[model samples]
Target: MRKLAVIVALTATVFLASSCRAETVCPAIAQASVVALTVAPEYVSSVKSIHLKACQDGRCMGADLDLVPGSTPIDQGCEPGSYGGDGVCSATSSPDGTLTGMLMLESLTASLIEVTVTGTGAAGQPLPVRALAFTPRVAYPYGEQCGSFITAGVVLDANGLRQAA
Candidate 1:
């Protein structure tokens, strides 16, 4: 009975520790899509994205959105695309298309992600992006196939977290 009690206690302790580990703990590396959306030509003026990766200790490598590519041909008149078919939806983080910038992961939770942008353009201004919070996460409902490159089907703030305006 003594041995059984000890085993049960040990198991309980392990279980508790595991449960505690489930709490939010920053990872060694992570990625977030900080996109400004609803852009014309590519996206339906409703999709955007952002990206970042942990590079070194206390430092990270950031990425800017490739917005210039948005000049690509786009069909303004959208239609219901096949969910499984290889539709025209596309996205790019090149330094020219869409509104994107460097991504800095400050912290993250199951429902919330804190990040900042340091590249690309926000409202035509070469402004540095502040660490924005993805409360409940930013998701776009109006998604098209061909616009992924420009729309990227991603997001940051619902109001388009751009710099100038």
Candidate 2:
């Protein structure tokens, strides 16, 4: 009787443990189409390359834009990185060409701005982009805190350029 009770208890514990296991679902990552990046007149001359990325719930998607070592800035650039990887920009558009979401970028010292392109082809297709501007805001001194650092409101895309429904 004692052995049977122990076995039953172990079985129940195993069943409960298995049932209590939590499931983690990763969010879907989509590629972003960069249409244009315009820097302020003051930054236009000093700007080199602008790294862009899309984010949902604080996850950065696409390639990191490094705008330091280059000659002649590019007006239009492709999505920085590949999908499901760090330093990449994800798409905020639905299956169709409509943009109901936005791609975000991490704040750096440089000023930048992203614009969404829409319509059809080179003249009309919809393209949404998040622009980051290099401004004299609060700077994090070298090494300070031990948490995620986020600088919001650096890029203004208030026109619903990249909003996904």
| Candidate with best lDDT | 1
lDDT (C-alpha, whole model) for all candidates: 0.40, 0.36
Q: For candidate 2, write residues 62-157 as lDDT tens digits.
A: 543432221233334345456644554344422321112223444322233332222222234333444332322233333234222233232213
Every model's TM-score: 0.26, 0.23
Query: By TM-score, how accurate is candidate 2?
Result: 0.23
State in Å the error of residue 80, model 1: 14
Give the Å shift of residue 35 in candidate 2.
14
Q: Across residues 1-165, which tens digit of lDDT does each residue of candidate 1 receive?
A: 999999999999999998877444333332453333313333323333433332322444455444433333543443456896455655533332444333333432234333354333444434345454444333223343212211112233434443223
How much is the lDDT of residue 128 in candidate 1?
Answer: 40
RMSD of 1: 13.6
RMSD of each: 13.6, 16.4
Query: Candidate 2, which segments miss by more than 4 Å at Cα?
Result: 31-41, 45-165
Model 1, TM vs. native: 0.26
